[model samples]
Target: MKHSSAKEVEVRVKRTFLARKKPTNSLIDGQVKISIRFHQLKVRFKQLSVELNLFNNQSSDDRHIRCQRIGTRLHIFILIGSSIILALYSSLTQEIHHETILNPSETQYTTLAQVLGDCVVCPCSTFSVSHETFISIKPIYHHICSGDFVSSAWINFLLRSQFIDFVLYSDYHQQQQQQQQQQQQQQQQQQQQPQQQQQRQQQQQQKPPPPQQQRQQQPQQQRQQKPRQQQQQRRRQQQRQQKPPPQQQQPQQHQQQKQHQQQQVTTTTTTAQSVASAFWSFDNNALELYNSGLDATLSGSPIYTTSFAGYGAAISFTRSSTQYVYITPKVLPFNSRSFTIEAWIYPVSLSSSNDYGIFGQCQATSSNLCLYFIARNNKLLCGFYNNDIQGGTIITMSTWHHVACIYDLTTMTQQVWLDGSLDGSHSASAYNGLWGNTAIGATFQLGSASTFNGYIDNVRFEARAKNSTEILNDATLHVYYSFDGGSLTDNGPNGINATAYGSLSTTTGRVNQALQFSSGPYISYSYTPFYFLGISGSSFTIALWAKPTGSYAQQTILLVEQPSSWCVHYLVMTSTGQLVANCWIGSNIATNGPILSLNTWTHIAYTYSTTNGIRLYINGNQYSTTGSFTFSGSGVPMRFVLGGDRVVRQYM
Candidate 1:
């Protein structure tokens, strides 16, 4: 069998093929095995040959190309088959994990190639399937596989479920946050409430007790304490009484005490005469008598004297067609008696001789007496008249003079004062008699006859009169105004027509003239508005006499213009008794109470100032007031109107 190498190999191959073909079914099986073996052997021998060639010739490009081509083909085939198997396994696992296909039915064996191809991007060797494949597939493979095996309903269900879960979670979180905020606010309020309550309690504790309770207890405490004070006072008094008197008290002390007692008695005597009767009659039997003897030229005429109620006597001298006659009265004694004589006189004509008409005498027919009066030539005279001769001085008689003759018994000097001023004085002789008489006769002829064509009233004669120093020292005179005619007029001389508001009338002697207004018919020449004086400072006080006929439509009682300013000073009632004073200082306004009444005379006064604003008085009592105010301008002007203006009213 080993004839030659080539012949022997060929013979063996031929013999093996014949043997395999001899047994038919067995031959086929053997052939198939041989083919598989041939294929494997061929692959192995080719790899061996390439390895041998690579070893023999290292730079052969042809053999390398053939080997790379075979390897690439095998890798492609293996990748395709593996991707199919992995895709099927991944699908089954995803279905089990998501529970979408758990307990598979008839659809369990479905192909997974389409799902894998739709889910995977590249099906080459680089592709891989994993458990996180579903998330990676949502954007790309979800829409892609939606038209393939997966239903749109399933995808929509999944997406809707996820959105609802997100919404529910967000709402729950927000609700929790709100609840937390509310709890924090509640805690803060709880903490502050106690503090507020504590503050309220503190305020209540600090509050004072009611005024009524304090007032109710005050009097009781005072009553209980008063007895103790009284007891203490009594003890002090007893101690003082138990002490002995000092022995060092001298006779000077005794004398001082006696002098003090005498002073007290003198003060009591003076105080008793403080309120003297206004109707004290003049002593006609004084030493210096004006009409002493009955042998005077006025003996044919009746004597003139004042009544108790009347102020002065009106003496009439008859005129035999205007002629003058002389009359003289007997004088009496005078010794150290201080005397004063005052008379109000009005003459009809002052065209006679400048001689003595009315005189006061001290001796028989005027031996030594002071002549203090006015003469016919309008000259004032004040000196002594001696031995029935007028020799002192002379004053003119046309106008009236408030003549006052003061004789100082201590100084032994005679002085005359006119209208509250010292006019003249002279040395007087000493006389013994301290009584006198006065006379009225044709010597003081009226209208050039015994018929005196003049009037005289308010004649006053005082013996032992107080001096100016003594009168000025009186306290009553300072507090109240004197009823003398110097400050006010109760009645004019010779029963002249005059009246006062809110006074004791001369006719009735009762409280009358509370409210009054007067309006009259026109007169040619007369004084219209009345006069008021003695007003000072910034206060406003209005007092007048008003006689109203009927209820007037518009009546102005008082209107005071402010000095250099445009504001009204006061407004008084003419139709009614109301009194109001307004002071505009800068920008302030002050008002007083009403003082109104009708058809009667009233004394209404208003006091307004910057400090003591306004005070209203009816009669003599203060009625109402306003608090203090500050004034704007200086004050009201001095010249103001009362009643009605002549140029405006044209009536009296």
Candidate 2:
């Protein structure tokens, strides 16, 4: 049993040993596979390194070959490019030459010798275009030190290739220069032509000696022209007797002639000065709108010279139906060819649809020659009717505005100036309206066309075409009234006295002393005819300042009445203590209810239009309104009676 057990143990140990051998062989096989793989990998690495080195050497040689091929190709390209460039250069040169042939001398370019120095030793064939050549083409590149190389053959060729382009633009620059020169020459010629024409005119204007017989003129004129003519005769006689050297006598004779010419001009001017003496400048404190020039005073003095003159006292006219200034018709020189009329005016009130006369020698409504302010359109009409009244200007009211008009009979041109600016111009084709009917008129008048409502200062009427500057700065005025005297005195040569109508009181005012109308007459039950205040048309506005003395029994502040004509325009009132406006037109009457409180000074305005009828405003704000009304009854001459109605035989 022990032997059998021992055999079994040996068998088991052998089995164990066999199993261990099997595992060891597997481990040895795995290690052998790993060793073979490492050897194969190392060999593969060496082979790869050898192949990599060979590829590197071949790539280096390939690069060298590529470089040689590229260099050879570049040389070929350069040769081909040179040929193409040469052909282009030839073509461009031909084209430029063709253009130069067509326009001839009209376009000229800088010659080759001008652009490049005259290098006779260098053949143009030696020129070749390159990057350097193009660099030279840049204008600023000229500063580079190319020295004489710029005149070399290739540079000359490059220039020749682009010569047409440069020449074409250069031709334009030349044309511009030529045009400018030509224009300057034309301007010079034009300026010289006028001067030459003026010289010719002066030469053609030489006049023959006047007739020995002296013509009729004013006393001042006779002395002036007579002496001037005698002096001119004496100068001519001296020129004939002196027999001086032609050279020396030329300047002396010219100087004397110039002086003599000036004297002659002064003499002729004096004749007009004598006539200008007929002009009326209201400078005196007289109740008359007098003519200091003609020594003839105006007919009626509804106005007076005030102490408000900037130069002297200005003429103050009370806007009245009966007051108007007039000069006798026969006094004006009818044969005078030209006339300048001007004045400075300050409009106290400018209402719509009213005409404030500035001055007139004829009927204002008939399109005759007249100057007036048309309040409807807010325009100044300097009317000179050859056939119809025409020329005018737009002028702002309330502020001081200077108005002037010039009538040149020779040219028949009428120019209107407002506030030192030319307003408009028109041609007067006929003479009958302005110059022909001088004797038939009632009188040359100032103020109150119907009624003029403003102050007039520096009134001027001269028979000469004077510009605004000349008129404003005139040293020798036709009529001048300084208004420094209490009585009317002629400041001009022709001193005419004017008649005073109504009594006007002087009071301390804006300047020296202003004419003051009694407040009782202004706000009480009295009314002035106020011809200038006659509201016309279907639409009108009434604006005024009123200080209430604590409303008195439905007091009528203002009223418009036409006596027995059955015409009533408005009746403004202070009812209780409230302000109200009532308007009547046609057969309809409208009321703009109570608007403002009384007892305090208030500005009340009522606008009446055919469309809206009536609109009431208190202190510039809308207060009440009314419906439309169509005005009729021959459009009565309605005066906007302030405070009460005492005109046209009516009452408060």
120-176, model 2: which lDDT tens digit per residue?
Answer: 121111222211111111221132324565656756555333211110023344456
How far off is model 1, as Cα RMSD?
Answer: 57.4
The C-alpha local distance difference test score for the whole of candidate 1 amounts to 0.42
Q: Least lDDT summed over 10 consecutive residues: which range in candidate 2? A: 131-140
What CA RMSD would you report for each candidate?
57.4, 32.3
For 1-652, candidate 1 gives per-residue lDDT tens digits of 4568889899899999878666658777788789889999999998875544322334458767666656766666799999999999888874522112221222331334345444432211121222222210112223244466778787776543321111001223345666887999999999999999999999999896799988998899899989989999999999878865665456667669968965644432211011111111222211222223322333334334332112223333333333222222322223345555554444545445543343333222233432323343444443344411122334334333344555666677666555445566666654333223333322321212233334333344455555765332221111111223212222322221223332221211113312222443111101111111112323434443444334543455554443344435454443344455555556546465454544444555666665777776666788777778655443222223333311111011
Question: Using Cα atoms with residue i matched to residue i, what is each candidate's TM-score against the true structure?
Answer: 0.27, 0.28
Give model 2's TM-score versus the native structure.
0.28
**Model 2: runs farther than 4 Å from truth?**
1-288, 292-423, 426-538, 567-569, 593-595, 633-636, 644-652
